[model samples]
Target: MLEEKFERLRNFLLAYFNQDMESPEGALQEYIEENSEGAISTTLAQINTFLHEDLTEQVKEQFIEDNCDLYFPALELTPVEWLKQVQAELKSTLG
Candidate 1:
């Protein structure tokens, strides 16, 4: 269940970043509001928790290695760090 949620969140972010969704930020805000009780920070914390605690190290590393470039450009940070940065950026942009 948690893995599915994380995948959904990741797909949302990818769509947002890739400009494949109209009003991606708005859509994400709506998603968070509906699914997470409008608590963006709490939702992000939950995502972070799932990333770090629920996934195995190898799985996490593979995911990061496979998709980091697609999401983050010209950055050498780990996947978790990139996620933190993206979350911060989104929060500021949405607010």
Candidate 2:
């Protein structure tokens, strides 16, 4: 199921980029707009599960620090909070 989800996302992105040659930032924005619910849900589920499992603390911290701005603009929120926000946004988008 996860593989299928990623395949769908990959196809969407390829088609998106093919239609309009956009900058990396523009592609990201378009990706979110085009696949908002799937993107958010898949990312949230993967990150949430990864965080919950036993992993290198350093790596996890580095990832959160690197992606916090991209995924969660609000710097004040914790990582878990960010995941919850993503999930909420996905639900709202799908609804």
Candidate 3:
């Protein structure tokens, strides 16, 4: 499930975000580990929570500040395009 998502995610990050794989992944993992004090809205809380300590004030503030047009990725392709890739690969196997 996740490997299929990497190209989409990487393209999104590269196009609009200041982050690369490690920085964004670290941020997300930190979000996952950090325990919240308040009743976190589910929408906000689902990003990540893997922090091991109280996050610094600045770091906590920037955790999920992902800047991307993730709703419509620039590298986005239609399902038909993906299917065509599969078809091309299968043609090699059948050769």
Candidate 4:
């Protein structure tokens, strides 16, 4: 299911951030390998589109509320704002 895959990808990316946000291509590669069911480029494109276009603001807010503990203390952004940054990073990595 796309919904489950998206959540799994989100969780993986967030956990990856908890470790290192400076580099995400590695995480993206790992996720691709984990779900090696289709073309890697297609998977990446789908995820990029989902992060950049599909999710609604309300959904993003709820995601933040659900994962408050994942916040980085050094960043003053609210959870939703931080999530936007993460989304940008993931999109960049996809490219």
Candidate 5:
């Protein structure tokens, strides 16, 4: 259940916009846990890694564009499409 709710979304959403999360990953997870009807799909262990990484200072958009390979597999869709997905997910979850 967590996997369905958190794992894929976590990878996508966290990596979706940027390696550097707008907030610490744990806080973001907790926000998801409290805010969305879906679920917190990531592990605190991984969030811990995010918290400690250099990504903490990276810009959300820059991180996404630069690491396109990490976030977008095969680069099938254009970056704009990927960004739309990113925006949609964030709006759905965080709005």
Candidate 6:
């Protein structure tokens, strides 16, 4: 269950980074409400760990390379920068 949630979070971030989301904040809020089990802190902590610790630099770079053709043309961010941006957005949105 945790792994599935983590995968969903990863996919959410991937879609966000790829600019495939029309309303990221709303979508994320819904997702949290649905999956957080009334513990937003635990959910956020798990997601933060996934974003900040589980996803290594090499994995991120490889993901970027593999999805190079799919990213938004105007997005000029490296993998680390993208992760940071996602983290910041998540924090701001949740708070």
Ranking by TM-score: 6, 1, 2, 4, 5, 3
- TM-score, cand. 6 vs. native: 0.47
| Tens digits of lDDT, candidate 4, 1-95 | 44465665455545654455444445545655565444444545544565566667777556545533454455666655765655555455546
- In order, the Cα lDDT scores of the candidates are 0.54, 0.50, 0.33, 0.53, 0.43, 0.52
| TM-score-best of 5 and 6 | 6
User: Best-fitting candidate, measured by lDDT?
Assistant: 1
Model 4, 82: alpha-carbon shift in Å?
A: 1.0
Per-residue CA lDDT of model 3 for 3-92, tens digit only, reads 232333333334433434344334434433452323123312222221222556344223313333222233253322322332343333
Residue range with the least summed lDDT across 10 consecutive positions in model 1? 64-73
Error of 2 at 93 (Å): 2.5
Q: Output the lDDT of residue 42, model 3.
A: 32
TM-score of each: 0.47, 0.40, 0.22, 0.40, 0.29, 0.47
How accurate locally is residue 58 in candidate 5, as Cα lDDT from 0 to 100? 37
> Which window of 10 residues has the lowest lDDT sum in candidate 3?
43-52
Model 3, C-alpha of 63: deviation from truth (Å) = 36
lDDT of 5 by residue, 1-95 (tens): 33343344345544533545443334345555564344332333333343344543434334444543333445465544554543444455634
Residue 42 shift from truth in candidate 2, angstroms: 3.0
* Candidate 5: regions farther than 4 A off: 1-64, 67-75
| Clash list (residue pairs), candidate 6 | none
**Could you give candidate 2's per-residue lDDT for residues 59-85 as a string of tens digits?**
555544443233334346564454455
Q: In candidate 2, which residue ranges exceed 4 Å CA deviation?
A: 1-31, 36-40, 56-59, 68-74
> What is candidate 6's CA lDDT for residue 89?
54
Clashes of 4: 0
